[model samples]
Target: MAKNHLLLSFSFFSVLIIAQISHIFAKNTSKSPIVIQPYIIDYRNGTVTKYYNGPASFVPPPIDSQVQSKDIVIPSPSYHNLRARVFLPARPDPSRKIPVLLYFHGGAFCIGSAFGWGDSHYVAKVAAEARVIAIAVDYRLYPDFTVPAPLEDAWAALEWVAAHASRAGPGHDPWVAQYGHLGRIFAGGDSSGATIAHNLAVRVGMGHGPHLSGLFLAMPYFLGSKRVPLEPKWFPFSPNYKVWPYVCNHCKGGVNNKFINPFGRGAPSIAHLGCKKLLVYTAEVDELRGRAIWYYKRVRTSRWPGQARWIEAKGQSHIFHISKPDDPATTKLIRDLSAFVNSN
Candidate 1:
């Protein structure tokens, strides 16, 4: 029965992708068929076969000298293969408990993984620099599972991490239980993952879960009914404009859904953001930079009671540091992030 739903979703998503691609190719003068193979979905088996082909997914990097990582499952009979990848400092102070960071990887809400090469490496670097025990959540992606699904998975992971705070649990992750300082926890992500992070913090603030010390949003994926000046208006050309409505069954038919657009109609107020501090980054060339800047301003002006700040990566594109880990700005971003995590 679950497989049936999965197949249906893939079918629906495929149709949408084809429609957008068709619209894109309509304007091209060349007769060559562009082979933009992001992913292949087997409707018959309800499975997705991934390769190092597109922006959707990538092979993960191995553990480095700065931090070691391990993957562990969190039992979920409702969903298959629910898990998290934990990252910890290579050299730890045995006597001191470390801060906890719950991270989500972004792929426009459709694809990406905690185990993805860039995201995993970035998390490991953050863990090492900040001296925090980080858990990169592996949530179900779209065309298999959708908006509320990813959001629910994130909540479950947070609960699982928080559960480790008590020694009575049998499913506790050893490293998290032994070393994670739940009192100084943070949640963050990039792109769609940043959307998840924002929603999670809102949920927490509304008395839904454990408290978070800070929230980090890197190039958040937010869209609204009114189009931004820089963004193209022709909806069929950009799949992102349509992703929210398609993947999010509960979005009421548009991009204004709270999950995608935090300040949209019916969305929760920024005053209830539910964190001690917030850091938002926008790339200079990113189309969504304006929206990110708008969010930063909103948070600062809101009665959220948190210190909010914005950082713009001049001359960089969206999430550029992830792909270019060796960039000087990447090091600076990591160092600044580490300072944020470490600050009292």
Candidate 2:
């Protein structure tokens, strides 16, 4: 029991190290053992407390003057109910058939909440600025579960969103049913969530899911056993590789599994992406930027028969916009997204 306790403590310590990586890798590392407060990592006895949780729902006057939000639970007998934070514009034009977006938050699939400030704030901004109803799917995390589970949770939420457009879809929700365009539904995520977006897109292509008009991959978390130039190591088995398998339940084929390494052997081809439009953008300084570039290239050369574009933000870190929503780069991302979903 004592050894196990030590192991868990060490694991929590490692998470702390990751949270402070942004501080450490910079030119001058802090001499003091200062614990950065970006997140409250209270992992103990097999539970993690990722401190980004925000209000489950927000009203215009209280949260913001532009957007209002509420909570929706997608019931699932297979697992617990998945929580989705729905965001709508404060002032609505019912005559406008705007698009709808389904987003997943990133926590390496082990932590993070849909109601978290980063996801809620970003999605709310998109809903207001881009004239779309946004649903932030709060899927289950790891340690208690693994892949296909999170994927299932995300699909279920997407299905619910798509239902809003189907014959029996009305009454599903006021915002989506009233304003969501029939053909302009989309999905996106940050980091690990981006990886989920890609996988979900593939599932949609396989006749296994609903139609997605487009996908916005923000700093997608695709990894491989092989080393990329920018990657500090071979990734899956590198200094922090344990987190991957741990999040995946030591998934079959280890790090080379199709879920983690989409480009590896026995994996589905990018040529099978079902979406009509895909936007893959990454920050300049993100360690995973190289893989995002690789993903874009694969999609570019594939015969998927879709419009694909790539953008690289100069002098930015991984998911910088999520951490700093007011940044100019974040605004650019939202602007580009608005144009993409509203193009037609």
Candidate 3:
């Protein structure tokens, strides 16, 4: 009877161990999946495929048929696939140098592409309407890469443009060589791209310069660990709550680092902003409007040696201009952007 009891006890313990192992496996598999694949991949054989499993769903055509556009792959030491899409005005005058705009696309630092349909269309329109040489940078995204990676790519693209504009030697982009005016350069973007633009401007302000004339921020994305008035109460606990830390893990101060939240407490003051002029466009209904407005107020009141202006599109939502470029409000915003870029 004692022998029988020992066998039964061993069997019970074995069953318990198996159940525990199964539970652990289920717990792990139940958690949300993290995506690590590239959103869009070019096979170097005239084929590009976009992975739809993640947020990056739109696959831009290889070429923008509406405007004179070309994709140039930037050689990078760290990242092998950095690229930029260059858009030229319909009537680019080789004799007259026009302003240049280095644009970044919005996708929460994770999803969008320079060659995405919306970005391509928007840059093409801006190039045609604003009569400026536009280059949309395709920076590395998150989960696979991280924050400073994108910033580094942006800086690299800017440098490349400056180099091409300064000297149109062999192997230079003809559009940039023919029309790009180095002195009147502008950096602009929407959403997270706007955030990158802001950070880039700040970096430039700290002694580096190709001399930015202006900055165009459309529905700029700025946030902190704490929630502010008019923002959702649960904002602090959202999925993106961890975004700053995840992307900026290398930052010394974590989420509160100057690069993550430039306007937050302890962050470098807006007085360090490099551009001579700042134009901020916000949609009234956008959840991020309040933050942009706050930034405008702070910059305007700060000792920054520049003019800061804000334009609110009533009843509009986040990134409305990019999604609805033909809308009257978007057209107005574009007109304002054109004027801002052309302004002295």
- Residue 71, model 2: lDDT of 86
Better by TM-score, candidate 2 or 1:
1
Residue-by-residue lDDT tens digits, candidate 3, 1-344: 99999999999999999999999999877663543243333343444334343454345533444467777876665647677888887656678999999999987676777877667777788887888888888898764777888888878776777777556553478777777888888999998899889988988888784568899999987886666666667666544444555556577666566665777666667898999999999998877777788888889999998998999999899888878877898888888899899878
Identify the candidate with maximal lDDT: 1
- Pairs clashing in candidate 1? none
Give the root-mean-square deviation of each candidate in angstroms: 12.1, 11.3, 6.0
Which regions of candidate 3 are displaced past 4 Å?
Answer: 1-66, 77-79, 168-171
**Model 1, clash count?**
0
Worst 10 residues of 3 by lDDT: 35-44
After superposition, candidate 2 runs with Cα above 4 Å error: 1-62, 77-79, 167-171, 234-240
Each candidate's clash count: 0, 0, 0
Q: What is the lDDT of residue 266 in candidate 2?
A: 79
Q: TM-score for every candidate vs. truth?
A: 0.82, 0.80, 0.81
lDDT of all the models against the reference?
0.79, 0.78, 0.78
Q: Alpha-carbon error at 25 in model 3, in Å?
A: 11
TM-score order, best first, reads 1, 3, 2
Q: Report the lDDT tens digits of candidate 2 across residue range 1-344.
A: 99999999999999999878866676244332322133334343445443445433332222878988888777654767787888888888877887888888887887677776766778889888988888888887754677868888878877877877665543387777788785777989998888888888988988875798999999898888777656665454332245665567657777678886777777888788879999998999877888888888888998889999998889999888788888999999999888887785
TM-score, candidate 3, is 0.81
